[model samples]
Target: MGNSSSSLKVCTDHQGGINWLSLSPDGQWLLTGSEDGTARLWSTADSQCRGHFQGHESYITFCHLENEAAFTCSADHTIRKWDVMTGQCLAVYRGHTSIVNRILVSKDYLFSGSYDRTARCWSVDKEKPIQEFRGHRNCVLTLALYSSQDLLQDSEEEESEEEKLSKDFLVTGSTDCTVKVWWVSSGRCHQTLLGHTGAILCLILDAPNRELFSGSTDYTIRTWNIVTGEQLRVFKEHQGSIICLELVNRRLYSGSTDRTVKCWLADTGERVRTFKTHKHSVSALKYHAGILFTGSGDACARAFNTKTGILQRVFRGHKLVINCIQIHNELLYTASHDGTLRIWDIRPLCKRGKRRLKKERSLQGRSSQKGSLSRLFNNKVGCVVHQEDGREQETVELM
Candidate 1:
């Protein structure tokens, strides 16, 4: 297959490298956090800068949008909730003594994981934190949340509010090389999963199987039974630290500093295949609309066919490491350490083969003669009879 080239129609405004991004539920807007210590809202329809929230003193580490408000955590040691429509800081949660690296929002609680070796639970209705989970010896690196419906979906009876609140759990990965599952209602450590030789970097839940998958700096990914706190399997093929993990349609896709993304059979933890394209660490990944997209330190984001393990598209433009990616409404939003947020339209590739061919042919018609070295691929080859010097020169032929 010939390589397909495409360009984006919009590049949102940001001054510093984007650290994180979140898309609105309706796909009409996007929120991005940057090293510039500010977060901005952009209109996806026209790529206009709609609003800017600027009060943080340091890098904006993460951002999440919930309902009509948006929350952002920062190296400034605070998480601020902003009204999406008005660009006003509604409330500031300032309990973390160190940088808040991540945030998780539930129905009523907002959880913040920090470098202070603690995870604090906040009432979304109030500014003060309700409970503090402190157990890991090192800083918490990531947070994941799951419910009874996620772990015990086969139960026929509807769960009571008491049972639902009791069973709701918060999963945290820490630099202490352990995974802790905490009951949200009690703030008690339900289970402490240990076995990693290095720091835990990321984690995800296998909802249907009641399993938890964690990746660590130790270069191995472990699968655990959340209920029993038992180690189910360990995938040790990655040569470097695992950076990101994504689950789609029962398949586990992991990105690693080893410069590859691997798929696993979530149920059995069996390796399905590995796809390599990035020349540097695969720092971020998102699986959406049947395509698995990955971003890396190599300054590229790629879309791969998850089933066939084929690289279908490559997104380029960043000058530094790509920190994150989000896909919404067939649009791929990428955050780069190069200090920009790029919006790529994947619709060109989503069309049928005939339509793709038509576009390719049109691009070919306009792109021919723009470059000097690709005559072989750009035009048909032909022979010309020698006249004066008995030497045939290059001639174009119609296909």
Candidate 2:
């Protein structure tokens, strides 16, 4: 209903909407996959469109940036590796029976989920899949890594384990209404969590709390024990599909097709607050530095206070829906249906208005309780600063 205070700076305009965004671990550049059948790299500092890697014949659904290299999955049913600095397609890995919807990487291996209803594990360098994991009955919509605890527990049971348990396992959610955890190394299914009556839209692992949270088209959010495959709780407040769930510290933030952002107790299924921040369906959500960033089909990325649920700043830079948002260091990056990516100076916003408001109010009190509002708000209170002077010593809260 009101104009957004923060301004948007466009970084690049591709031929199609950017679907997913990833930042290089060093934070030097950004990698994005789009429906244009390509992945592009942009310089973080200058906002320059550096290079584009093109090979996929269809929409690129996801991409992951690692150092100077990147990996992408596409609706074309293939995964391609690229040299980020040059934008050259270095290698192509093809084996999926349908569109590759997601791609994930560990230290040495790559994992992918597809519309073909199978998840595959591949060797990153050789571009060869070592094993195919088949269990889900429908499209694998989302994939997430599990906790070290689950991985260790699964390994202890095998008399002779072929899978070298990485520090984490993997969770794959599908349209068949099930979430499955797999042994990363052995490509074996560990647990299958079922309850949702509709398609699973998102799957997230809160390793610190040892729990998994999922959003679904069934208009519910479900929590489960990652190790035991036990259904912990179900939150049925949203009237529409819960498209995205953000876990900051312990607080659970969910964006929904109902055009609202709901805050909940991460560990328990208790509702804390509900606030409307978008004109239409909230397609994506991200919370960082005391700010909740949400992108909507209304063609804007809006920021709100994590604790107060008050509007902080609205960034309107795209002409179409924003699909995903990721924050790195001082910059906020967004991928949009307008076929472009943009970056903003988060320090300016986080250090000035709403950020200062958060520190002054102490809105988030201290608590170790999992999913408490305190952990959600206080975790992003910005970096504290202490200054010394000759006349008098004083402390200034910059953010």
Candidate 3:
């Protein structure tokens, strides 16, 4: 694969490092939070700054974008809602005594996790917090929400009166190495998941399957049944800290500080393949169609084929580590600690032609051989024979 920086567009107006990026639901606008204490809105079509949101007293830690509004949380110990088109601050939410790390907006309720070791639920129209979840002993790093309807339906057993009356469930993961499930209606923690020996860095919810996956500095990914808070499975192949995770079609993709990205069969906890092209820790991951896009500490973003574990393209130009990535309208957007947001057209790289077709056929042939051998030879010690490039090869193996 070759570097594709020539076709990249750079947006370098931010004076400080970008900490987070959020793409709007329609994919027409992008919002970025930075160390400069401001969040700006940009047009993805032309890479132009459409609105500049100001007024945060400290650097922004995270941001979320909606249809007509933007939400940003900062070290200023507050979260602010802004009108996306006009760039006007609509409301300021203040309650956290420390830095606000993440914000999630669901319906009319806004949920925020902070360094205060608390996650709070706030009314969108009101500036005050409606409920506070105060069990985590360390900074809250990630947040996810499960709808009330889904939670009720997924329970194999009858729900309690309190659970039936709950609005929704808010999930929080923290530096304390725990994941807490809270009822949004009562501000009470329903369950505390404890298994990771290190800080929880990221979380992704597989709601349809009633599962929650958490990645941690413990170098493992753990799955839990959200309904019962029962530990389901653990994926422990990574040699370093797990930084990010993406779930697509029951397949779990995890990026790690081991400088590799792994693909797993989500339901079975089976390791499918590994992509080892990254030169440094894989910090961010995004899955679109059949391609896996990654941002790494090497200051480069790469595209890989999920099926064959082949590197398709390399994006280089960022001067520092890439912090986040988003894909929209055939373009890939990357925000970096280098104080710039870069966008690249990924349409050309996504096309499958003669070369890719040939590779797929070769991979299929090898896969068939492996499947046949696995079914026929049940012995722990055996000689495995396979054909590659028209040559026969034999290898001795131990189970």
Per-residue lDDT tens digits of candidate 3, residues 133-176?
A: 99999999999999768755745677678778776999999999
**How many residue pairs clash in model 1?**
1
Q: Which regions in candidate 1 have their CA more than 4 angstroms from the true location?
A: 1-6, 10-12, 152-165, 352-399
lDDT value for model 2: 0.80
lDDT of 2 by residue, 158-276 (tens): 43434543455778999999999887667788789989999999988876556899999999999997767789999989999999998876778889999998988776778878878
Model 2 alpha-carbon miss at residue 393, Å? 30
Sort the candidates on TM-score, descending order: 3, 2, 1
Q: Score candidate 3 by lDDT.
A: 0.89
Task: Record all residue pairs in model 2 with backbone atoms less than 3 Å apart, i.e. clashing.
Answer: 16-339, 266-371
**Shift in Å, residue 337, candidate 2:** 0.8
Residue clash pairs of candidate 1: 17-339
Q: What is the lDDT of residue 392 in candidate 2?
A: 20
TM-score of each: 0.83, 0.85, 0.87
Q: Is candidate 2 or 3 superior in lDDT?
A: 3
